[model samples]
Target: MITLTLQTIGGLMIAYAALRVHHRVYTEKSIDKKVVNEMRAEQIVGIAGALLLILGYLAAF
Candidate 1:
């Protein structure tokens, strides 16, 4: 039961993060001042999402 809950939370977090990234990339005319570059943002978000997924998978065991 705990594993299922964790997995669901992790999945939701990943989906929400992805949606936020998509919205930012599409709606914003330019990258934020803090961000070094567009590619960097993509890489960071991608890695974070992948890590979340891996953690969720591991939690199932």
Candidate 2:
């Protein structure tokens, strides 16, 4: 049960990170310092989410 919850949350976070970049960053006309920073933060979130997903998968066994 805990593993399922973790996997779900992790998947959502990963999807949100990807969608945020596609919708917010992609629409920008130019790349600025702030946007770059936001992208970096999002990347971290995505990586964390990926880790959670892996952890959950391992826990299932």
Candidate 3:
């Protein structure tokens, strides 16, 4: 139970950080678009990780 909670919290933090970085990129047009794309990809990964974390927690019971 504690492990699941930790994983969920960690995933949320990762997703939030990704959002912050993603937004920061918008303020700088000189940055590469590929970098922005990578940020978007990481956001997707964070979402998927959160889903897996939830499923694992449920399965553990």
Candidate 4:
């Protein structure tokens, strides 16, 4: 039960991070400090989310 919840939350976070990164890469005109920080943040989120998802899958089995 908890595993399922974790998987769902992780999936959502991954999706959000991917979207943010995509937007930052395509829409931004310049690589400013703020943009770089945001991209790094998004990458961290994506990595954490992926780890959560992998853990959830392992817990399921």
Candidate lDDT scores, in order, read 0.67, 0.71, 0.73, 0.72
What TM-score would every model get versus the actual structure? Answer: 0.45, 0.54, 0.57, 0.54
Q: How many angstroms is residue 57 displaced in model 3 relative to the true structure, after the best TM-score fit? A: 0.4
Arranged by lDDT, best first: 3, 4, 2, 1
User: Where does candidate 1 clash, by residue pair?
Assistant: none
lDDT by residue for model 4 (1-61), tens = 7768876786877677696765678467577778767777777777677777767677777
The most accurate candidate by lDDT is 3
lDDT of 3 at 19: 66
TM-score, structure 1 vs. true: 0.45
- Model 4 residue runs over 4 Å out of place are 1-30
Ranking by TM-score: 3, 2, 4, 1
lDDT of 1 at 38: 55
Off by over 4 Å in 2: 1-30
Residue-wise lDDT of candidate 1 within 1-61, one digit each (tens)?
A: 6777777677867766776776666557476645536545675677677677767767777
Best by TM-score: 3
Which candidate do you rate higher for TM-score, 1 or 4?
4
Which one wins by TM-score: 1 or 2? 2
**Poorest lDDT segment (10 consecutive residues) of candidate 3:** 22-31
Quickly count the clashes in candidate 3: 0
Model 1 CA lDDT for position 5: 71
Please state the error at residue 34 of candidate 3 in Å. 0.9
